[model samples]
Target: MFKIGELAELAGVSKRTIDYYTQLGLLEPVRSETNYRYYPEESIERLRLIDALKKQHLTLEEIKERLQIIQNQPDAADEIVDKIEHLQEEMKHIQEELLELKPLLKQLNEQQIKLMTKPLAQQGYTLLHTLAILLGGDPFIN
Candidate 1:
């Protein structure tokens, strides 16, 4: 049982921000007989999540919708599993990209070693253009 000020301090937010969350129906903290707001331990984690979402630029309505989705879903872990699968696929692609980049990185490293051994007067004409010209430049490139 923590008071509003305590929760605010613990969560690294202001009392006004917590009050705004309550006003926006985002959090439902209990009230004492003196009509002061008190947050439970669960509210602390919820506040942390809310703060994280705000950092991601999520609107209050979007956060509320996500909360609703979690409440209405029977298997919330399903979402996690789907995300894990997606991340695995992305990881496979990233590994392929790294494999492809290895040769280029080795060549660039060789170039750097050559440049370091060269005389300072001969290091002026090294052109490190990218492979983007293979695609004839980006469509957005004018």
Candidate 2:
């Protein structure tokens, strides 16, 4: 068993972060008589996995939910694949929404072409307008 400090060093996170993970039941490090935390080698792997999942921006609750679902399932591999396929479909839907915005994009392109034939000073303003249209407001914004 490794002390909290040792485990933190091994995991490349602060002791406080490890403590927080323990509080969230993400890790189950044992406590000594003096109430010092101690973690096993397997806990290090768990910490690494939790860190990786957090990097994907998933909430701790979401991670816990996923873990529970994984634990309750018999075919974990197939369940994970199904979740991935669902995520892919969501991504495809977003892409379709972007593609459906093509008419506005075409109009913007025409404006850009018009600006290109104009004087240099006018081109800057038109470029700014194009950028504003592409990035400034939400497409569905009022």
lDDT of 2 by residue, 1-142 (tens): 9998999999899999988988888778888999888898867766655665565467997676655665476356354545555755775796797687656657667778566446644865665566456433444447
Q: How high is each candidate's TM-score?
A: 0.51, 0.48
Candidate 1 clashes between residue pairs 3 or more apart in a chain or in different chains: none
Superposition error at 58 for model 1 (Å): 1.4
lDDT of 1: 0.66
lDDT top scorer: 2
Task: Report lDDT (CA) for all predictions.
Answer: 0.66, 0.69
Stretches off by above 4 angstroms in model 2 are 69-142
**Residue lDDT tens for model 1, 56-78:** 45699877666556557636634
Clashes of each: 0, 0
